[model samples]
Target chain A: MNDQRPRILLADDEKAITSNLAPFLERGGFSVTVAADGQAALDGIAALHPDLVILDVLMPRLDGREVLRRLRRAGNWIPVILLTQVGEAAERALALEEGADDYLNKPFDPSELVARIRSVLRRVTPGQPPLASAWQLACPPEAPGQPALALDRRSRRVSLDGRTLDLTPKAVALLEYMLTHPGELLSRERLLDAVWGWDYPAGTRTVDTRMAELRRALGDDPARPRFIETLPGEGYRFVARVVAA
Target chain B: MKITWRDLLLAALPAALAGVAATVLRLSLGRLAVLLLRADIGTALVLLGSSLSLFLLVYLGARRAGIARSRAAIERHDRESGEARRRFIHRLDHELKNPLTALRAALANLQLALSESDRAQRVGDVRLQAERIGRLVADLRKLSELEERPIEQLPVDLPGLLEEVVEAARSNPAYAGRELRLVVSQVPWKLPPAVGDRDLLALAFYNLVENALKFTKAHDPVEVRASEDGRALIVEVADRGPGIPAEDQPRIFEELYRGANARGFEGSGLGLSLVRMIVARHAGSVSVRSRPGQGTVFTVRLPFDARDRAPVPAAG
Candidate 1:
């Protein structure tokens, strides 16, 4: 079961699909392991240590996204390609930005998938580019009051003036939303809905907790805030001139 | 059916009260005419005049209530059907796109084929996927036509139809080693013949049984049972397979809408929806009941044509 070909864990619920894709990938010189569901995909990744894994978003038991999120949260940097059903550009970019190597829309040619897999495996090889499947997101400080910050969406690495800063996924999501909607008067309730979702167990406390961590990670003093400005009765606001990254 | 009961209550209760009120008003007016003014001949005329007016009042009130109830039902039906149409269009893309993708992959393989046999195999793969897309388009057309085509109002033997569909299901390759049971029982009477186009009815029943076979495991028994409740012949195809999720169950019969749990199985997502349109054309309704991890049973009730009340001769 082990060989020189790039090992791929192909996770899709469709039997017809796995039968077709498995042979195509094998012919292209990659060892393929077909996982019928999301749980099997995770277990396959652990046991096989495949070079790359292709995940379908809609599967039984666990979806591809939960699998991707869990893997990233556990700090596993294995290159992953997501097979997304959505054709929207922004959603595809978001999937790529979700710490995945790349995204291919469903019903795509197998060769296109093979090309993506080969490219991803090459990037993860030693002596290649530093961030594998990474997208560099920099906020341009075009105006005098604009903030100078850069955040890597794929890697979740925040940088202030060329200095890299570490942040959790939650804090990154909070900062990402605020950065995109600069100067908007965002209430705590609004932030919670946008970032943590209404179904999230924690109350407004999670918002304050993540904000505190964001400020700490960025080394910003709440008393004299540089980016996140908190009002006494109101909510937090990004006090910087910004443009869409 | 529940709505029908509610509507009946809405109309009947109000009409009954109006009838009592009309009686009281007639007696009061007759007494007032005779006692208050001492006019007997005029009292008879007054009573005669108020009867028609009171009848009109009650008739108009009941009619209005019926109209209101019908309006609400139509609004709800339109809303839900519109939603189903929207989902059908949404899923239409994925259903076509996946097969086309595979077809393209096969074509790509054909170009890379090294030997004659390899080339032939690739060509076969291409044909298979292309045929799949063709079948999907054909099924869609058949369903749309079924919607427009006038159904033949001929007597359809309910028990005979079930046996035909069940036998056909037994012969299917997928039904190998699987048990499909068909039971027809009409308490105190033989099964009544349903009224519809006979071929279409058969297709609908066959699709239901096929769906059961598709979802259940190879060894699971798929049962088709037909019974009559005086007004309709109720046929159910029950399978001991993975039950549909509560959310997906409602939309499963919508054209091209596949359940999340059923994505692993290859399908055009047209079978159940086609069954829906067919049964609907025959003046019948279909419903599903399922519990996740336990099993699912699809029930189709075809109302026996009211005019055709005679039960079919019992079959051995």
Candidate 2:
């Protein structure tokens, strides 16, 4: 309570996230206090007056939004960052509009969290400032070398390993459909209806041609394929890992 | 809608006219009988025949009018719901697009990230969004598959399946990964085995319980109960979290339907729809009853064969 380190109140009901994150934040040069739920978080904020608060959006009894509402309603200009679990845009916008200085998604890198906290603190207090959990829990953020394949839907471009590959409209459509619906056994009918219009004058073979062209562009081998797999007599499956950009 | 006295009088005027006409006819018939047959019995017979025919005509006409009114109501309801269905299509795209847009930005940031940690951080961002997209795609598939194919039928122990569903939900990594305990109401019973794909039924129950967990605190009782109701098996999952608003209750089971409160929470919006579809596939029904602040309860009724009435599999 008397030390120089900025105090941070990290409130989340999830023990796994809080357990690993609290230690990481403390090690990163902040005195971390934890609250199990939103109501407890409100109590902690009033009693402790921590430098900053990192709130989780979903909690028992009172949710993160409700806590933020009460805090802002009471004219407390405390800096807050929301750890939103859903990767939704309207929700992110709503979170910020509700007076959060900044927001981060869950299953995030701890270093990123540290960076966000630093930026939000500097902006809030001019020089010195506040607080936040996260990272090292929830199974270590999938595997490395992720997102090898990325698709830009706006430009209708498909990129592999950071390079945009030249693919026809049909190939793009087919790949886009496959990328979006991963691990699905897509029949020729499903592919045709999705990529091409239902009334398009083409048969299932049209789907096969698009598949081959897309495969050729992706440089995926038909045998032991890394990206897409052909399930004989059934349908085609997008077997590769796709991180949608 | 506010029925004035005038409207009521107007409604009664037709019946009143009919009564007056009958009375007049009966009197006239009586005079005719006195003039011709010279008997009061003749007057009574004519009145009885005429009144019986009038009553039959009124009954037939009223039934036809009632049916026409109901049919119009049903058609209006269908049109309104069709409009609602179209309204929901716009919601699904945002779910996938948001994650993908974030992923793209992160990948773009990776190029500019100077330090090794920053690059790692950006990649981590990309990975998380990709996984989020992965979950949405998988959920969509899960929903579509239920409609596109037939379900397998097999004898599934009711109590055992429910216990396993609660168990799996308790350990679900989505509940902040670990050490999160769900308080499920006691689920011990003797009942006939339900005949359906065991895995799907398990998924249905697990989704229900997980939804309950999402809205409620860790210590809140996610009440689970199972009982036999004549020819069906009834299972209920209830929660004491903020109950769904009345307006959102009807659309909650639709695909990609995120309620006002649900949007702030983490969910794909397909969980309940999947449960509904799974129940439908087995000729069962899933329904929700909730009051704001009081909580929500989902009841699933699966019809079982009458022959398997033996109370077996008392295992928990």
lDDT of 2 by residue, B48-166 (tens): 66766776666555555556655665776788788766766787777877888999899999999999999999999998887777667657765765685645566777787776666
> lDDT values of the candidates?
0.74, 0.70
Model 2, A117-171: lDDT tens digits are 7656654642212211110001111357543666665456667666779876556
DockQ of each: 0.01, 0.01
**Candidate 1 TM-score to native:** 0.44
List of chain B TM-scores, one per candidate: 0.73, 0.70
Winning model by DockQ: 2
In model 1, which regions exceed 4 Å deviation? Answer: A1-245, B1-84, B310-316
Deviating ranges (above 4 Å) for candidate 2? A1-245, B1-74, B173-189, B291-294, B310-316
TM-score of each: 0.44, 0.44
**First chain TM-score, candidate 2:** 0.49
CA RMSD for every model? 25.2, 21.6
The all-Cα superposition gives candidate 1 an RMSD in Å to the true structure of: 25.2
lDDT of 1 by residue, A1-245 (tens): 54677788999999999999999999999888999999999999999888788999999999999998888878787888888532222443465546675556555668868877776675464322224234654566656854578876655678887787776555676787676445556678567544433211123444776688899977778998878899877888887654435
